[model samples]
Target: MKTGKRYSEAAKLIEKTKTYDLEEAVALVKKTASAKFDETIEAHFRLGVDGRHADQQVRGAVVLPHGTGKTVKVLVFAKGNKVDEALAAGADYAGGDELVPKIQNEGWLDFDVVVATPDMMGVVGRLGRVLGPKGLMPNPKAGTVTMDVTKAINDIKAGKIEYRLDKSNIIHVPIGKASFTEEQLTDNFQTLIDAVVKAKPAAAKGQYIKSLVVASTMGPGVKLNVTKY
Candidate 1:
């Protein structure tokens, strides 16, 4: 793949062999971002666990103190009064049966997050194959499936994020935007790091956090010294 001129230039600024401390890595990522629009800063973690084992799965959610610097369009699956409650709480779309068909037939999935009430899980279950692969399925563990529709919608809009290891035992989370101050980004980074550390599975052995890297949307990745976190 051919690298763009901006990307090539950004790559030169990073030391390929050196792992930087959290603050230095965050500052470097912001400095290297040259995108015309506000670029997102993301943290990628490589965990020393087998993802295939059910006991070793690492998954949870957290609300970033500084938020994700993006508006989250939320869809709520609920019936009757709950629907109105969700919308009043700032949900982008709120419905029950009507939504399932639209998503299944028209394939209408324009929202960023999906929330469902416990009673609506039967309906939500039918769309699992559709929403599951997209990571849009409402799961209880992620707090997306619950009776408190209003609280869930508000939290999600407030930058609550779900993190889970992929097939490669790696989890990628957006800490904040490159436009955020180094201090703001650092706080978000620390919050996520603490959460991931606390979520370590008992089945996980060896180094829990194998490696970590932080980068802007269009910038080269800056490796972080895991021990410092």
Candidate 2:
């Protein structure tokens, strides 16, 4: 594959076979960020579990200590006084059935996270076909589906992120932006890794975290040696 000159240069910084420690990996990721805009720093984990099996499914949420360095836009599905509660709690958009056609007809999905009250689930369920595929569906496990819209919105704004194994048994999530300090990124990284470790399914066997990689949005991946982690 033909790669850009900038990408090639960034790739050169990473040792193809060497696995770096968490600190070194984060530093390398930040150093290799060549984008003009603030690039997102992401952590990718290759897990051993098969996502196809219901018993081996690994998924959960964790709040980053330093936050993800991104302003999360939140949409709340609610009715009666709950709608007002959501907006007051820092929800970017809050409404009921009226917002349905706007999303279905206008293809309007301006928010990053979706939070719904227990009662508003019926109204929110109408958009399941559209939202489910996008990973925006509010699930109880991820703490997005709840009656406490305020806490949900606050947690989301505070950098709560969900991690789940994909078809390839890999989980990818952004830790923070390249513009953040190394210490800030490291804190978020540790928090996420700890959460992923604790969320291991009982049915999963063999190695849990097979491989770990950290990289900037436009940079090459730097492998992390988590054997000691």
Candidate 3:
């Protein structure tokens, strides 16, 4: 069976961690928080009901954080009004009909994400065959198809981490690696947990945040028992 440590373990680790001062603890926390997933993360996205859906179509955004930790060129399909906006918003490459063939080349996937203004979706939609398989296609449900290019670009750059429920409805995200100082990792974990808890949909009742865990690269996982805000 897979028995895991309880939240008390984290509190114990917190108490046992040695620190000369508050500042030192802060610095150490940042340096020590890191974790490595055993498997490859293909798609990272945030999901929630838009309140418009009875079934919760899972609306959110996905960006190749760390730019996929690899180089990904971007293709934008837009015209007239939204063209310049896409570029200024930090899209790697932005254009209209010209972008389709570029995406056709086997190498087009070298880019990470593709964004299209709602107006241009008609044109960009044609490239679905090329972009869909690569997981590079833009979908409105993911918040990629939008007129607010600036917000999209800024969110991608700001370490907009994602969280989603597993078969157990438990959401997970990496706050930091084990090497990070306890304080630094704690802040990251706290920030993400707060956001997720606050994002709870009306359909979710009883315990919204079921549980939380913090682990480090090559370290064991420790659950966190969060109190309601």
Q: Looking at model 2, which ten-residue stretch has the lowest summed lDDT? A: 1-10
Winner by lDDT between candidate 3 and candidate 2:
2
lDDT tens digits, residue span 44-126, model 1:
99999998999999999999998999999999999999999998999999999988889999999899999999999999999
Candidate 3 ranges with C-alpha deviation above 4 Å? 1-75, 101-107, 124-142, 166-170, 174-184, 227-229
TM-score of 2: 0.97
Tens digit of lDDT per residue, candidate 3, span 21-79? Answer: 42333333333333233311121122333334454322243342232222334556778
Off by over 4 Å in 2: 1-3
- Model 1 has an lDDT value of 0.92
Error of 1 at 58 (Å): 0.5
For model 2, how does the per-residue alpha-carbon lDDT over 128-198 read when each residue is reduced to its tens digit?
98898899989999999999899999999999999988889999999999999999999999999999999
Which whole-number lDDT from 0 to 100 does residue 179 have in model 3? 43
Model 1 steric clash pairs? none
- For the record, the alpha-carbon RMSD of candidate 2 to the native fold, in angstroms, is 1.4
- Which segments of candidate 1 are over 4 A away from where they belong? 1-3
